[model samples]
Target chain A: MEVVKKYSETELVQLLQQRSGNVFSYLYDNYSGALYSVILNVVNEEELANDVLQEVFVKIWKQIDSYDSSKGRLFTWMLNIARNASIDMVRSKGFQNSRQNRELSEDVYSAGGTSETKTDQIGLRKVVYSLKEEYRVLVELSYFQGYTQDEIAKMLNIPLGTVKTRLRTALIQLREIIKP
Target chain B: MDIKAYIESGVIESYVLGMAESQEAAELEQLSRQYPEIKQAIDEFEAALEKQSLAAAIAPPAGVKEALFSSLESEFKKDRSQGQVASINWGRYLAAASVILLVVSSALNIYFYNQFKSTSTAYQSLLAEKNTLIAENQNTQTKVLDLYNSMQMMSDPTVIKISMTGIAGKENNLATVFWDSKSKDVYLLPNKLPDAGANKQYQLWAIVDGKPVDAGVMGTCAGLCKMKNIPNASMFAITLEKKGGSATPTMDQMYVAGKVG
Candidate 1:
């Protein structure tokens, strides 16, 4: 459904405060496909993908008030929510292992220019792709999987200070790459 | 804190990405107000993350948009349909009512006190008259004893007791057929059963072997009810049947069952 209509952040939020269909339609048009793809990638099963899709909207309804344009764009906030939910689905013991045969993270970058709409990770993959292994891994863990740098440090078997350094340099590389 | 140096340090970027600890995030959030550039930097970082994350979206089902809108209408309409009823505090109303009652009673008390001063004997005489009526009622109390005795015999425990429990996962459901085996009658201890909704009623079944035969549709009991002549059977069942009942038991919706033997 190519319903991804344009709306300013404030107008969209006001519509959401009213809980208008226009707002949810905008959400469906813009985010549903991307989130569905995200969830499908993580859970790697169609049924759970559908379930997570339903759950994502339910979360949006329940948590509409939590979104703040001052912090970031609507898509970033929603992506964070969708990612966390999909991760929860993957982590649940009920999900059989080995079902996720293909790399799910690749699907994250494959969905055309949805990420280009926001600013922070502009050419994130481009810069990240060029990053040294340490910085690249840190950027992936911190941004994609929503891991805190502290957690990334432990996962990457590095010191916390080094994580902060890698993340800083990684963002520099991303800035240079995405700088118009 | 030097805001430009701090922003250049890329700590705000880390904070925007949610990799910063609470203290660092709080500090950055605080400093972002002091310097708009830091705020702008953080906002830019947030925007970029949004763009990058947008890569994850997948097309939902064909009707998901319709489902979302319909659900939104249903959920959001509850408040709009009922227009806002600004709830009045009933407690405050009760307090005002009690104060009004207190003032009225006190005024009446004062007026009565002044009247009593004019003829004190009238108040004494009225009280004496009320005592005489009470004494007359006390003299006729013996007949009430006979009626109370009849009620005791009817409610007596020789009223048979059959044990019952709720269906598994339905702890509120209960069925007990208390038979006055001598009278071949049944009394359901409905006090134990959870309440059901309108037009919904529980039907009792007398099961012979595995088959359920209808016994009777239970009548509402404040706590207890008496039904006549329950067939002697090995087991009793309760099912959510129609307003009345089926001639035979419906096995699927049976709420509770246990054997008498």
Candidate 2:
């Protein structure tokens, strides 16, 4: 495994804009894994995750013009694109048909508890697990599944305001858990 | 602004996590610039989420990279091949050069022909400008002659310059009425007034023997213009009325008044 050298956001953005080979390699080495993880969490299948990751990167390369620095980080922007692509894949008729026999758990992500996760990730996962069930579900729906506050509220049969405040409390709990 | 309360509101977290609506996201972008604390809170939450994502990072299947980079290499090669065609080709350049020389000679002929035509057109315009200048000289001479006569009248003590001040709503308006009592000639010079609409006009009234008499209708409120002379009037007033003046002054529309001393 090769470690991608770190770059300032400015330098990375310039290289990405120029579509440099060196920068593309660096981006792949640094971000592809984290992006793959996000996709895997959403699709819950290694093969579909692989396909979605490839599709996401292609979309990123094609839509590089739409990326803006003022809106957020490069990684965050890429994360957003990756999350949407994965969620879209799982929502497609093909994906639903493939999984027609299995009952999809409302909190399917919690099952990753016993999977072979990274050592550092295990610590973070522990922090996530320590959060109350309500807080954890909000984090999962919002962070992993990419559900909006309104969507989360509708899905859980909760008020929109309560969903917003609960998500805030969950983040506060996360801050307390992960604080140095 | 309670920066702490704003941070605690979880809107920043929602924004960072890509859960904020379009409008709320725009506001968060603006707030980050306005408040350093909001910016810092956003940065911290982003860093925390980034860490969590990184920890769960799964090295993609090894074949995926081999697949992705090969496609990238093919794209690079395609670009290079397209660039290669654009590089100088001596044989093609020699053929193009001879054709270009022939075209260049014809283009030069057309260019010079246009230059000559435009020069003649410019010369004709200059002659027209000279004619206009001559006419303007005659017009200026007439104006100078009128000014000389007006200056002669101004120096005469018999002609009085009455200053009219604006009244009520038209407080900023002003005008001057030059009265030559010996000749009974009244000239109105408007300084400023609220612009009346196209159908409105300012009418002048002379106070003669405790009764209002029509002085004249002032049209367009332009330069020093003649008005009906009332040699025995004690005071003068201006009123806004319908276009072409009115039979009687609209008393409530009186904009300015002055008493001759």
Candidate 3:
């Protein structure tokens, strides 16, 4: 069992800015699992998610100086990076072509129960999946896939006002379910 | 303004999710600063999102962490090498420019001498001035080359940089030691130290198994001075000593000391 050291947010940020390798290791240990899950959620392919995860960490290391604590927590900032990188990987031309082909052969791949079952095994992922179908899809698209409410509205053929309301409701419900 | 309504409007949620437009996000950030309750609401939502994300957490494959660290290490090395390349290019450019200037000046000297034999004294002064400029440029080039070499040595991956800071009374004194583990070579940079004057000099010591071994005596140098190598050592210290140096370190005269990691 490894004894993990704890640092306050301010201390962590200071050490990170100083390029302390120890702090970076501590950061990776504490947050990689959460960040990896976020990337996996967006990309949906384990191999691609692994690549995006590495890219996200590299981005975080390079751009840590740009991180502003006043805007949000460190993890929230990292979560956004993870999601955006994953989304970028999925949105690339090559990825889209491959994904289209994969979808065509989805029946064969589904038999293996890869990404869906893996996500379902997690406790909170199940809770998130249990959201009302409308709310769940909205949460998945906007939160995991880095889509805006307007974009979600356009994509889902719903009104912009309705998108905002549904997303708000969906998040509020998630908050309620996950509240300890 | 209705802060409660603003908080309840889910704008904070939008911002946390990174779904908010730039203008909306900026406004919320400003509002969060102004209102404690709005900040609290944003914090609560961010906490919820963090919890949700963590709940879905999956440990990456076993070798990923090692891969990430190695990539980072290589990235750093790449950056350093790029910097060295840039500096080397600049040095070559400067040298080329100086050589061009020297050649052009020599051509002018010959052209002026051939055009006016009666103005021979003026030509002699011009020749002297050109020679002085050439010498100055050569001196500068030598200094630049030395500085570049010192930088290259200091930035070597095998070199462990140790900053030895001043002891209690000599708090302003500072120096650095770059010890190459593979070659067992030591280089010292005297960053700040009181002048030892004529009779006394600074001596470096490497502590091995609780005893001090003399590394070398300091020479007055602007750049890194090569010191004697110690195959095994735990700490390094510098002390004021007799000009030629002493077999034993003068403990009370210790200026700066730093422990090896």
Candidate 4:
């Protein structure tokens, strides 16, 4: 029998609540790749990204019982968790070294598909690198490190308000640079 | 309201990216409610960053998923209900407990070793007593040899000899009081005196026809005490005195009375 893929997150969560392994297996098979994609973006190491992927799923399993439907969708929550885990790795000394070279993979979609949206990749990389060195670190901490602005401020030992200001400044600079 | 400038700042984008400090985070959260457009812009920024980073995705290690699931499954089951996790590895707990036990036993072993050390202290004290007695015996032998030589010298016809015997009131205490009148040297061999107690000393007295004269103080002895010097007296007696000795004996407390003739 052909299995129907789930589109509604609520049904997926209900299936998870019933403690069904098939639903979990399907969930892993489907979202694992996307989660790994998020992990790789921040950790930049295939092995570490994979490790984070496992952690992300495990965390979901442990904390799933506590999920409330009122707190938005599972996708949003998962994204936050995945993003946070990925960023955590980037902040670590081990993953920090993985940030060098091959800006935007240079030759990325020449192989992945025919869309040739590589220009967008180039623009994003240029926008990020265009940020001042301090702003770049702040951006990396916020975006790639998955740290909240307060976390960024504390990690950098700066004022909480300054983190917000720098983030505002950096995003404004990026918007100007990548106006296209 | 400078609302247009605030919206233009792209702080909304940073807030959506989870990059805002608390002040900014709070401002952005409030603004996300104020302007749905700001929220929409944040979503767009999030999507772009996601796509950009997704290109760098790497495959994780094999079986890591299994390990994570196992831990999560245990944690979830134990949390949702009350039963202990049977599937949890016993080796980890056992290893930790064993390490703690080893530390405690090591400390206990040190405590016992110190206890054994105090028991040896008594053995050290007994060994000290044996050494003291050995030295005392050697000194006494030398004194006896000197007394024999003195007797040989006093046998000369020129040396005077006197015999001192205890009086009736002190029959149990007597001394062979020898004297050389010309040399003024004497030896008092005292026996039958009670043993001394802590801090009390014995004194000797010389009597010339019932008048007591001073003889040097004598050392303590339960058996025999030998004292030197005789002051041409007809009698020798023993008395107890203070530690150093009194200038004169306590006549009423005299333990032994003797006459030397």
Q: If you superpose only chain B onto the true chain B, what TM-score does each candidate give?
A: 0.38, 0.49, 0.50, 0.41
Regions of model 3 farther than 4 Å from truth? A1-5, A101-117, A120-125, B74-261
> What TM-score would every model get versus the actual structure?
0.47, 0.53, 0.53, 0.39
Please give the lDDT score at residue B47 for candidate 4.
50
lDDT by residue (B1-261, candidate 4, tens digit) is 466687778766655454545687777767666777766665556555444433333335657667766765654454433333333456668878899899989998988888778767877877888888888887787677766666675576655545444556766665555566776675555645666566767777777666766677776432233455665677677777887777788876577664554
lDDT of 2 at B125: 97
Q: Taking the tens digit of each residue's C-alpha lDDT, what string does model 3 give over A1-180? A: 122549988998887887766678788888888888777766767888788888888898899999999889998999889878888897799988876655422422232455555655453445668688788777777766567778778877899999888888777787778665
User: What local distance difference test score does each model get?
Assistant: 0.66, 0.77, 0.82, 0.62
Compose the digit string of candidate 2's lDDT tens values, residues A1-180: 234458887787776677666667778788898788778766767788888888887777767778888777788888888888988897788987877645434343434543323321442344666788889788777766567788888888899999988888887888766544
Which residue pairs clash within candidate 3?
none
Candidate 1 per-residue lDDT, tens place, A1-180, comes to 334458777887777777665566666677777666655544556667677777788888778888877666676667667667877776666763544443544433433443222322332444465677667667766765567777767766789988888788787676555443
Total clashes for model 3: 0
DockQ in order: 0.17, 0.22, 0.24, 0.15
Better of 1 and 4 by DockQ: 1
In candidate 3 the C-alpha lDDT for residue A146 amounts to 63
lDDT of 4 by residue, A109-136 (tens): 1233433233223323335655777786
